[model samples]
Target: MLRRLALATLATTAAGLGPLPPLPLLAPAGPDTLTVTIAESGHPDADGTFELSCGDKAGGNHPARDKACERLERLAGAAEDPFRPVPEGQPCTQVYGGPAVAQVTGTWRGRSVDARFSRADGCEIARWENLEPVLPLVRG
Candidate 1:
């Protein structure tokens, strides 16, 4: 009787071990997101400069031309220098005054993505549409 009880207890313990609850599969990393960095130039009256690193289809937009231009002008004024003129031989005309709006098209991971920017301090301030994907995490 004792041997049987010991055997039964062992069996119960073994049964309790059952296969480790399906190891909750680890989630895979999703697509990358947009990243922006702003730095203040030491020079007085220098508008802060920003660098934007775009990722995947996560960034794109179609902001109104006038609005974009306005933003660009503000950025330039803050940066203490107007937009740099396009190189002498460049196909695109030099942008000056107000905002600089141009369709921003790019390729990432073999996919085509588009975005718009208002040139500020020689950098692009991403519009709402382009910034939407990254807003949630950044907000809090």
Candidate 2:
């Protein structure tokens, strides 16, 4: 009965007609999700993970998801690199602002971001500062 009906359906499908369509995939729990982490080099207490989401509705563990998303959107649109590399042979002041490191992973505006940021030198410090509010500048 049931078994025969099942076999008949399977046979019909395999006979010549196209196979059944695949099931629809479920939407993600949230769009534009990001996992952000910041740590002060050598300081374990300052490290923590923040989950964020941005889109028509912005929300997540991040304290300022809306602002963070706004900054990220701006960064994505900027002609200059938000995390521009320091040009070779260009001398920068020997300034060690503080060894703060940040990691941003996940999707933003439907694009992946697996960027690490650090303030090891003047150029790096400038890059980190540009990402501020999104990745807060750590002071020693």
Candidate 3:
């Protein structure tokens, strides 16, 4: 019986009589969108509000949309919020990063996120750099 079944299957394929039924596709990722605002008094050109949408597709006016989206996707698994503020009383270096300030507001991975970033202190600077192109790179 096994030999007969195998032969039958082989004959069906050789006769070009197989086209598997299509499987249903899954839904795309939910809308992950954000509005990023950066302010730099010294560099007026870099100060502006930019839109960023990331999910199955990356869209919006952000200059580095693809890279930003990739970075966001990579960070999705972390337990910590990328935009979260530094913990109160956390030790941070006294070195000044700069005057650049940024705010990111959006819904990411089904959670609402509103994170502020700055280069005021070491902790703040690390938070800002954590997002990379999602937040503009600044030099102090």
Best by lDDT: 3
Q: Write the per-residue lDDT of candidate 2 for residues 1-140, one digit (tens) a residue.
A: 76876676688788977455555664355477888898865556447788888777778888777888788778767744454456788787778878678888887655467887887778778877787667764764
Clashes of 3: 0
* lDDT-based ranking: 3, 2, 1
| Winner by TM-score | 3
Please give the CA lDDT of all the candidate structures. 0.33, 0.73, 0.84
The runs of at least 3 residues in candidate 1 whose Cα sits more than 4 Å from the true structure, single-residue gaps closed, are 1-14, 18-25, 41-140
- Model 3 Cα lDDT, one tens digit per residue, 1-140: 76866777778778897643444564346878999999982566668999999977899999898999999888876655687788899999997998999889988877777888889899998988889889887889
lDDT for residue 25 in candidate 2, whole number 0-100: 65
Which lDDT value does model 2 have at 71? 82
Between candidates 2 and 3, the lDDT winner: 3
Question: Per-residue lDDT for 90 in model 2?
Answer: 75
CA RMSD (A), model 1:
18.6
Window of ten residues with lowest summed lDDT in model 3: 19-28
Q: Each model's TM-score?
A: 0.18, 0.63, 0.75
